[model samples]
Target: MRNVVLGVANTVAAIGFVLFASIVWSAALPLAIGLFLGSLLGPRIVRRAPQTALRRGIALAGLGLAVYLAVEAYG
Candidate 1:
């Protein structure tokens, strides 16, 4: 399924980010803590939300980012 693939990809990306932070960033501790908290709390928060609202918000955000990128590209 698409969600499964995306979830796997996101996990890999998160691992890569943590590895990079550990190797290069002195703020890795805080970064790791924030990531840990997000991982712990994010699913619980999202699970209770309305799916339609979340989808709409994501679409709006993507559209806004696209418009911003277009303007930035043209300017």
Candidate 2:
């Protein structure tokens, strides 16, 4: 299944990221703090948002990122 393949890919990517992070010791603390804060506050924020609003927000974010990348690549 596509989900199984994606899950395996994500797991492998996560392991690779951990290995890369271990080599970049200085980033560990900041990444840890960010992970902690996101874990703590992310769900709470999402829970309060309406589903439609959340969907639009995600779409807008993706669109913005695509535009930024396009500009960076070609402008």
Candidate 3:
């Protein structure tokens, strides 16, 4: 029962992430880069740490930098 509940929760979260990414994808390039970098850096920044605030900040910074670079390179 517990496993089933957890699985459902995970599925819901995954769907939400996909939907959010799809919305960002509509912006074309910059947002796609931001999302990609966020997925890559966000985990490392937040891993095995109890500091939620710092993790969020680092993830946001990474996302911003990725978007900026993408726009500068392609735009």
Candidate 4:
């Protein structure tokens, strides 16, 4: 989980840097603030959550999304 988070963070940082000139500050500023706040608080919240339960919930959600997409595509 830690590796996955780090991988995505690094990739997003690179992409944002490359597109720095094209980003609309008006639209991105509010979102950037929200994300900054979430980054500060999310780890504290996750530390208190049950690991097994979190894993189960995530697996179920992935499975549900896969099933939904499959049905939508084949129906």
Candidate 5:
């Protein structure tokens, strides 16, 4: 139920991003920024208390760093 809604919303967002990317000059930058923010914040919203928060924060930081490197390598 909730998962399905979230999945659908994410899919719609992805499609919207693709459509916008096709027409926008520098869409990748915004996409990257969005990814970074989502990675940094999403876990905090979903994770339980205590250790989960720490784990999620570390995971998000790693994701952000990886995205940054990938963008720099390709862009």
Candidate 6:
């Protein structure tokens, strides 16, 4: 739940930056669409996912994201 809020906040901020900065939409549109679709389907997925697996998956993804951000910021 908290991660969902953080993800949403990051998404909104990214969208704002993209819109205000006038970045190349063509370069990012596909990735954005895939992410949006994946998130949109999460409810259906959750219905099928086992509780423990879901928690592990989310934790793994969060760790991956943290590492990616750390490298992007300080690597």
TM-score of each: 0.51, 0.59, 0.34, 0.47, 0.35, 0.57
Model 3: pairs clashing at backbone N, Cα or C within 3 Å: none
Tell me, by TM-score, which candidate is best: 2
Best by lDDT: 6
For candidate 6, lDDT tens digit of each residue in 4-68? 99989999999899778877778788988988998899889999999999999999999999999
Model 3 whole-model lDDT (C-alpha atoms): 0.84
Backbone clash count, each prediction separately: 0, 0, 0, 0, 0, 0
What TM-score would you give candidate 2 relative to the actual structure?
0.59
lDDT (C-alpha, whole model) for all candidates: 0.89, 0.91, 0.84, 0.89, 0.85, 0.92
lDDT of 1 at 61: 100
**Model 4 — which ten-residue stretch has the worst lDDT?**
16-25
lDDT of 1 at 41: 93
Model 3, position 72, has a per-residue lDDT of 100
- Candidate 2 residue lDDT tens string, 1-75: 999999899999989987775566687789989989998999999999999999999999999999999999999
Clashing pairs in 6: none
All candidates: CA RMSD in angstroms?
5.5, 4.5, 9.7, 5.8, 10.4, 6.0
Query: How much does candidate 1 score in TM-score?
Result: 0.51
41: Cα error in model 5, Å: 23
Predicted candidate 1 versus true structure: per-residue lDDT over 25-70, tens digit per residue: 6676888899899999989978998999988988999999999999
Error of 6 at 42 (Å): 1.6
lDDT, model 1:
0.89
Please give, for residues 1-75, the per-residue lDDT of candidate 5 as tens digits: 999999899999989977775655387789889999999987886565577777888899999999999999999
> After best superposition, candidate 2 residue 66: deviation in angstroms?
0.6
Mind sharing the TM-score for model 5?
A: 0.35
Better of 1 and 5 by lDDT: 1
lDDT of model 2, residue 13: 90
Q: Which pairs clash in model 5?
A: none
Question: Residue 7 error for model 1, in Å?
Answer: 12
